[model samples]
Target: MAFSLGPRAASAGYRLAVFDRIGSTNAEALARARAGETGPIWLVAAEQTAGHGRRQRSWISPRGNLACSVLEVIDTSPAVAATLSFAAGLALEAALRTVSLEARMRSPGSENVTFHLKWPNDVLAGGGKLAGVLLEAETVAPDRLAVVVGTGANVAAAPEGMPYPAASLRDIGIDIGAEDLFGALTDAWAEFRIVWDKGRGFGEIRRLWLERAAGVGQHVSIRSDSSTISGLFDTIDKDGCLIVVTSDGRRVAVSAGDVYFGAAASVGAT
Candidate 1:
């Protein structure tokens, strides 16, 4: 069966395209946007075969999961583009709250269940993973750009033998209908767009994000291609960089790196 959203859920101004299955919502939305697709387009799929995550990791997407992407055309700097993930994280958190999951913001630790934001865009839940966000942008016309925001939430079950710990909404005893979750996400996106257009700055979004931030003030290890650094998790910069205070008392800003907490932090640094 095809997935369709009701009018009361999403903004009436936007157009939604639903699919029974797809290779990746982000890829489809990117192709359409590059082909001159206009603003406020939502691409959704019931299952994804080749879903993507940050740093080219395979996002484990199964049937009955939520895989969707929204394409928006806006004129903004790359810095603003970078912050889109954080904004989306806030929006996703709000969507989850609507389902009454009692999903509080948490960092990776020895606790039972915790969700945290890993730098640019990954939502970690409990001892396992929950959801993630991906943002890709391209300039199609002069002063005009296309931004594709892709999101995947483990509504039913997580992939088997995952690289890291992962979780699903069902694991937490929250049974949110997939369609209802999609509606909430779209509505949240619409609200975020309004804030983005008004140039109100990222203060509000950032504040909400930090409130749910993972590993803030905890020791973390960030690994990139060339090197590794470990330090206390500080704050996310306006440009979306993960700020870490190293043991040497130097605050190093990590622009792009895989953040790992707990014992994985030591392993990631190497």
Candidate 2:
């Protein structure tokens, strides 16, 4: 099925560019922004030959997977632009719930599936990574920040043997297509984008994100480029940083890092 924006997104004047295959939707969106395209546009690809998540970790989207990015140009600081990813997380999770529920109802007695947003930028299902969100921003113009919120989901298949466990909608017994999921995401994004209000409504977004967060109050270890910190998953602060309470009762707010929970925290620390 061809990809098209949902009714709400279309009404919101969000444009869409669908590709059968692309190198990266995020790359394409940023390129458009640099070319003076000020847009709230969605770039979607059936497959992504080359895609990377945070810190250049490869994220390959094969056929039947969802590879999409939403681009917005706004006058905002990079710090504020960073919080947009939390809104994106909320949007994606809402979309996943909508599509997954529809798929589940078709099959009688399908096992229940729950989704949660992992700290930083991942969507988890059954305690395994189901999808990931990445935010990339650049100063294309003097005062315009070009922010691209990119997401890739394993609709049909999940990679095996990764640092953490991975899962797919199919693996969870939900038969869904990338096109259907993309449509839902476009609509969901429209709603959350308003709630975000170009970072003005981040307080609401932060609260909503924490409501569906994956590892809050659990043992967690965050690994950054320089060092690894182990602590309890406290909560995300107003600015959206992950706050972890160390064993010594110090609350450390991590701006960026790879997070692992429970026993895997040790493995992630190493």
Root-mean-square deviation of candidate 2: 1.0
Q: Please report, as a residue range, the 10-residue window in candidate 1 with the lowest summed lDDT.
A: 102-111
What's the distance in Å from true for residue 116, model 2?
0.7
Question: Tens digits of per-residue lDDT for model 2 on 134-228?
Answer: 99999987878999999999999998878778999998888989999999999999999999997999999999999999888999999999799
Give candidate 1 regions above 4 Å deviation. 1-9, 101-115, 198-200
Off by over 4 Å in 2: none
- Clashes per candidate (backbone, < 3 Å): 5, 0
Give the best candidate by lDDT: 2
Per-model TM-score versus the true fold: 0.89, 0.98
**CA shift of 135, model 2, Å:** 0.5
RMSD, one per candidate, in order: 4.3, 1.0
Query: Which whole-number lDDT from 0 to 100 does residue 5 have in model 1?
Result: 50
